[model samples]
Target: MKRFQILFFTAFLFLCANLLFAQINAPSPIPDRVVLNLTENPATSVAITWRTDVSVSEGFCELQPAAEGPLKKEDSKTFKAKTTTIKYEYGDEPVIDANQHSFIFTDLIPGKKYIYRVGASDFWSEWFEYQTPSVENDKFSFIYFGDPQNDLKSQWSRVIRSAYRHAPDCGFMLYCGDLINRAGRDVEWHEWFHAGSFIYGMVPQVMTPGNHDYNDLMLDPHWNAQFTQPTNGPKGLEGTCFVIDYKNLRIISIDSAVDSELENENGYPMQAQKVWLDSVLQANTKKWVIVTTHLPFYSPKENRDNKHLRKHFQPILEKYKVDLVLSGHDHSYGRGRVSDNPQAGHKVMYVVSVSGPKMYEAGDKDWMEHSGADKQLYQLISIDGNELSYQSYTASGELFDEFILNK
Candidate 1:
């Protein structure tokens, strides 16, 4: 009876211990992969998007100027700034259902270093720091890459890392759509983030949507969830389409998907965006006006010519005398001047290039002054007053093409 009792007690204790271990060993719902968007407005404001496994009913961020004391012992400049947080929520689902959150920190000082960290009820994120660009810099540079579609892990990572290694001091990074081949898959999005991890947190990123960025004949959940841009520009064209102003540069991004089939029959071209663009261009006394889209008006890619887009937006670009039009979806490089008469003043330069593993053959065309095929490239653009300098570099950081635009 004594042995039986002892054995029974031992079995009971063992079962309880196993149950406790199972409960304790369960995965913790912690916030992860916090990415700071350095592209939008980095000086006056910065945006951060992070993912969490558990739903956070309420959350906020704390920020302070990054200290350069230890790094520069000879030069001691103590920096301090008040921290602010902008609260937001997506869907009313429970914590387990909610996965992504984005917040914008505004009213920041340009050219100042700021340290920040996010906090939530279930879990708290680590502290990270970044510096805002100096608005006073007359000559500023940025990186432009397009279409990181297909083979994101092995091939695309090289291109992204190469660009970062070459231009570490770039003010911002512009990705002209198709960040991933399939947007619905969480793993692919993770790979996209992994490929661009080095620069994604450091530099500001402005992204446009490519056809592959979409899923199931609609906007992809991943793209929509990760980015936050100006939605107040046009009523119907919100996320996929918007406009942002940085220093003397006014960037206008449009959703080619909407205008691709010429389906918006209610004077679609002449209605909202046209009026808004006219007002923006006319009102914008900025030194440069840049338009970015996923689809190029003239691309060498098979079955990728956007005739309707050219007919609708080309006149507007000419009327506004836009400085440049950057695009991708061609998987090759093509640059041309949009003026029918060369002496009639440079209207706009339409450029298409790719920065992914995919390559396409370039077709011989009269409009194409510079063309490249069988290579992966990204563009580095420098704007100084009236002069705009552009250099196209291959994945290995070799200058493949170069040009200048004298405004």
Candidate 2:
């Protein structure tokens, strides 16, 4: 055990040293931490967000047909990005003052490929190509990752890379919260963005906030500044909780950390979200509904129950017969249905998974149809007209578990 600790610390130091060297030797003026996301309507709208040093204050995105020649820059439409000044501080590091830029290109031709890039003046990122979903409902697949909370650069990078390899054309990827071990830590966020690399620029990200994503009982400003999500959530929870429609599926993200952890301030109770979520689920017109929260209603870890969260949200989920609920927080993996008996009526399939190096012993409960301890896993979910298919895979690309649901 002593030798293992020594080796682990040595490797950690080595990784940090390399990161510092890269930052000191090579700094790009264009932009870093570029990521894509879906707008309220992904078929006709797409959003991109990125960060730049304070110098590059003004930014814009250029879009053109993917087939157009590279020299046709004059024919592309340039949209000015909304820039916000973001200041982040963590630990002993000096405060970071950076500019975050966001742009949502709307009224786009559906089912067509387009190349886009973001920057200002003479500095710009490489062209990134993306395709909009069909205007009408179409079959699509997406990847879901749970709690990439530890060893992001050193260990968690493989999980996301393998997932991309498994589903290169997935419409988008969803992070079920706990993206990092520390909240508002610039170094940790850098590790996360570095681990994902260009994958974030290719596939849009749908994310929720986990308990670990907060510092001092409040969300890190970096989250709201970096992720451009739908703003149709309840008060005090703008981007953290909202709903988006993609093809035939409706995804509702909930901020379970603040309320369940008793961090609610200024009357932002779970009840408020209960009312909003009930309405959201009630008004959902999509054939399929998938709700994602960081804390699981049915806990798979002993002594770590979120009864308050379940009390407020599970009824709505079961009432609406939500197709699936994806979540992570216990640092373990479990997939299960609501009932142990086969005769149970309508139920929602709940999944808790992990994607980082952290692991915890599983608490074998009767609800778990499949349970795994000390494993890093990702899930690929695909939806057709009347059916939804789910497959779980390990870091090595092994099929860990799978199931199918019919509407």
Candidate 3:
């Protein structure tokens, strides 16, 4: 009896020791902050990114075609994820550290649904499905949000969820900028990811960095680490200023580092973007063209005019007859084309909106056709051939304003 008891105790201790070893080796290897970002060609490629604890040195993504019935793991192909360790220090906070992983799936069939998940080794995320944009010139839509900077989990989450409810089939989401209140604070980025939850994993993102996304107009290191963007911009600016030709429209993202107080050897980053924009617009073969950036070319509030932005970019946009100029930073909602005849909307439509809980009264409203304040709003823009339809909705899913432009 004594020998049998000794054996039982030894076995139990061995089992516990193995469990502890496993725990230490794989400490919270679960993937989090998973997001999908757009590549240059949405029809044939997509980029995905995620995060995990430092224990997960390596990561992977499993891809499978979507079909009816249960997913068969045997039918899926595994692709390794590139992982990088990110360490951040807040103003007076402890250092935040984690592993970020990213992968770009290329040569995909257009207009097809694909299932994927990301993780390392035995830990993985649940299967998420995303549809590719069709190259057949079919109608494509995307959701646009202004600034999701404050009260992310408590307030901004509802705005993103409401956008999902409205446009479940959106090809991708466009964030004008100011995604958080701080530049390099990991907690704010965590809240931004938590607010979107699984929605970000499915629909890809196209982002422009706002002032708050930078410290002293210097970009946060997290941007380059967490995102893999198009390298089509001119020298000195690659991911921040890029052009993606998605279906019938040519989408261009420009950086606002030159809007006010930023300087480099290249003279304020905007010069290169202007040259790139001119070339891209001159050679644009798509039926429509839209530009999205952080600061508005036309400010919607008093004493907030972006004179430099207007002086440098306005002529180029007018010369090419760009369809829309979407931007944030005013914290109020304003949409109108600056034309002599408001009825004859021959020029580009400029829109400025906000999605966070922050409120700012519009001191300038005479130039706004559809204006509102203290309302968190989202816009769904659809393009089918020559007609583009835009609908704006409040956080509670009420339609706030809308407009349609024909090319």
Best by TM-score: 2
Question: Which lDDT tens digits does candidate 1 get at residues 189-302?
Answer: 667777776466667788878877665456666665666666746776666677777777888887775544334635553367667776777877677989988888777655
**What ranges in model 3 sit over 4 Å off?**
1-27, 258-268, 339-346
lDDT of each: 0.71, 0.86, 0.85
- Clashing pairs for predicted structure model 1, backbone only: 38-204, 39-204, 39-205, 55-95
Q: How big is the positional error of residue 382 in model 3, measured in Å on the Cα after superposition? A: 1.0
- Model 1: worst 10 consecutive residues (lDDT sum): 80-89
Give the per-residue Cα lDDT of candidate 2 at 153: 93
TM-score of every model? 0.81, 0.91, 0.89
Q: List where candidate 2 sits over 4 angstroms from the true fold.
A: 1-28, 68-71, 260-267, 339-344
Candidate 2: the clashing residue pairs are none
Question: lDDT (0-100) at residue 20 of candidate 3?
Answer: 70
Candidate 3 at 90: error in angstroms?
0.9
Q: What lDDT is reached at residue 212 by model 3?
A: 88
123-176: candidate 3 lDDT, tens digit per residue? 999999998988799888999999999999899999999999888989889999
